[model samples]
Target: MSLANLSRIARAEGDPKVLQTGRSSLPTADRVARSLGWFSIALGLTELFAPGAIARTLGLDGRKGLVRAYGAREIGAGVVSLSTERSLGLWSRVAGDALDLATLAPALGRDNPKRRAAALAFTLVAGVALIDVVAAGSATAVHARAPNRRRNYRDRSGFPQGVAAARGAAAALRAHDDLATARRLPAGSEAKAPAVG
Candidate 1:
């Protein structure tokens, strides 16, 4: 089945009243994740640049351990940034990826000209990413309130049809109840006849 249909089913079954909430919950979560991911990158970079000093200060192997840990962090940050779906989330991802690139830059400058140049290039690209994500978040926000966001898509697959049917069933039930309530009501609200014995 199409992804849209699956989403509809999951939402309807999960929460029938899902449409009631507003869209004010996107920014904070993405920001927090971004901050943590960047911090991971910063720490990784520190370890890379002064693995021995850092390790000795903290009581661990400095160079090899630092490289391994920081490399792992960089890769992990890249994955998280890539996977996040929200535009704000994407920004966080960008920030994280940039942070990793910055960490790589100093290591490149240590000795090997090739590695140094590569790190510098990555740092530049990562800076661009920061700008990209900020714009993406704003773009998504504008897109959300464009007044016609829902009119673009027509082929809703099978799930929307199923939801329509379920809505039909529910509306029919409500109408029946309304009619029953009307029949059983007194004509005047002030006074009612005694129940028939």
Candidate 2:
């Protein structure tokens, strides 16, 4: 099956909202990116509201402004992700995740009371970054492909749609062949005389 079909089936099975609303479907990777987008928004809200606390937790003594700046970046990424095409938004999130890791990396080695907490946060952020990379890659690939062609149930161009259609097409083709053969024979000759029962 095409990636689009697989994503549709997966979403239909997993998301109750899809069933209830009967809304248009999105690809699986796009769904993943949307989830990440929500996550970014939540995380940004936390950081923007509690920058001082987050800075302390990460072993930063007076970097509340930096934390808030990063929070703004997260919020921007989240907004872009939610509003834009999957590939671009997802890749932007990946970039934001990279920036987050870069900002947090120094705390891992610092001599501070929250060193362990910083380490744990670093690990969690790294794991999330991995997910962002994966979702970004999948979205990139899905977006790179051509749009899907809808299946035509009543396809009629002499191509088989089902067993019945196949049989009907084949019969029509055979009759056409018979007529062509008769037209090519001598006027007095019966084309099927040799094959008569």
Model 2: per-residue Cα lDDT over 1-197, one tens digit each: 55555568557565643224345578888788889889989999999999999998788879999889888888888887787576676778778778888877888775677889888888898899899889889978877855697667575655437666655332322333476775665543544344332
Steric clashes per prediction: 2, 0
Q: Which stretches of candidate 2 lie over 4 Å from their true place?
A: 1-24, 146-197
Clash list (residue pairs), candidate 2:
none
| RMSD (Å) of each candidate, 1 decimal | 14.9, 14.4
TM-score of each: 0.31, 0.61
**Location of the lowest summed lDDT over 10 successive residues in candidate 2:** 168-177
Error of 1 at 91 (Å): 1.8
Show model 1 residue runs off by greater than 4 Å. 1-85, 113-117, 120-131, 143-197
lDDT of 1 at 61: 36
- Top of the candidates by lDDT: 2
Q: What is the lDDT of residue 112 in candidate 1?
A: 45
How does candidate 1 score on lDDT? 0.53
Error of 1 at 61 (Å): 12
The alpha-carbon deviation from the true structure for residue 57 of candidate 1, after best TM-score superposition, in angstroms, is 28
